[model samples]
Target: MLPALAAMVFTALLPNLDQWRRHELPVLPAAADGSVTFAGARVTLVELSPAQLTTYGDQPFELPHGVMAWRAVLRLESADPTLNDYCEIALEDAAGRVYETGADEISRARTDFATCKADASPAPGASPTASASPTASASPGAAPSPTSGPDAASGSRVYETVAYFATPVGTEAVAVRLHFPSDAYHDYRLTPQG
Candidate 1:
């Protein structure tokens, strides 16, 4: 009787691995219309256009608060068998200030996706707001009524990454960047530069 009882208790106490991972793991962003699929990976927001930025729940998804945590799954286009390539996730403020997160300079290793949660607030005039949550009007995966034509791919290596920006609840815009942890691709790698 004692052995049976202990076994039952242990089974109940053991954490569900999937649930545990889900809590810590980051999911992919919802597929957005007109965004091109690169290297068989979905580049959800190819680029944020001017009209999309003005409207909420539209093409341009709302930029996140500097403090909110975001996740993006990135993969090496061509994995090197002999050497482990390094990759990094970065964020840029409207003023051109760049904030870096993800794998350190020497390695492209991380627990899951490139995660960036703001530890400090954005500078004055560069903070994003709470009203900017992109999935506000409807559920995250709902289709947009107007489908814009797909944009041309920039031919750069694509990595899926989600990021959170922590700022005063009113930041309108931010630029995001991606780079090899080696800093091999310095220019033409940043996204959301407008």
Candidate 2:
């Protein structure tokens, strides 16, 4: 009886091999200024910096005591529009702390977009340019509505995604992580910038 009970307990405590093979192992790392081709689409981390802007839109306010605004602009394009469905985007600092977009008052302020996606119809400056999160009416996790026209397929759709993070003044953002850990494409290959 004792041997049978130990076997049962050991089986229950065993690691989930199926999930590890599917989710935790696959990840693709990218450079701050380069593009990576995934199975679904082409993704580029255009520029990343601790932005030095006096304002986001036509508003102004103060940050907490010691914090700064960091920005990362990404470029995405694909043959299938469903590539726009990357559900998770976040920044990882050197110490491995993650700061998700829209986590702070400044990040949630009215800017260009709430999530990363391609605009089937490009409209520059169409979004409300407000600060202090007043006019952030852009739908979170939604792509702009595509225009109804047959000839619109002549060109590939390009999505320029801008994401922001508010962190402690001296924190250095190490990597821009995309998608969630539980996702199938979690496999990462870091390409160091020369």
Candidate 3:
């Protein structure tokens, strides 16, 4: 009976051992205009920007002293035809300070970060001559455009969002961290261009 119990315990621990081995892998790194594949989804960090203020619709939002708003533009593509929901985005400075993506009013507003849509083709039966409307400029000290995320269409899409950080006024040398939801084993880091 003692041998049988030991065998069963070892069998149960096998999966955990596999998980531990997976965690031993090194963290992945990327940069602006670089891409990485995680859990079968292809993710690319297109652009990163530091801003003083942002606009939500017509409302202007500003950060307090020693704080700034950082934006990241991501392009995701997957053959599975579903959005990649198992991911977290954050920003980290050289001093190891981490800042999470904000959900405040200004962050919630869709401001335009640089986004390149995968499918530029118009809908079937739609006129090719149709054009987008002109947008009015935001007031001084506000972001110039509205923010938007990926459309609900299947396949590939572009995602743009902002993360706010409370760092010293002249803080540079920051990098974006993309955490996988599946396991804490690995994270992707993307350093922005100066």
Q: For this target, which candidate reaches the highest TM-score against the unseen true structure?
A: 2
lDDT of each: 0.31, 0.53, 0.50
lDDT of 1 by residue, 115-149 (tens): 21111222234333222122221222111111122
* Residue range 8-84, candidate 2, lDDT tens digits: 88787664453334345445666454556554555666567876534555555456678887777655556554445
lDDT of 3: 0.50
**Alpha-carbon runs more than 4 Å astray in model 2:** 1-26, 31-33, 52-57, 80-83, 111-114, 124-155, 180-194
lDDT of 3 at 87: 61
The better candidate by lDDT, 1 or 3, is 3
Per-residue alpha-carbon lDDT of model 3 for 1-194, expressed as tens digits?
Answer: 99999999999999667445443545577734466666655666555667545466556666665555666655555544133445666666778655555434345444432211222322234343332111221211111112124532354333333334445566663677777757667767776543
lDDT ranking, best first: 2, 3, 1
Reference-based lDDT, residue 152, model 3? 24
Which of the two candidates, 1 or 3, achieves a greater TM-score against the reference?
A: 3
Q: Give the true-structure RMSD of model 3.
A: 11.5
Identify the superior model by lDDT, candidate 2 or candidate 3: 2
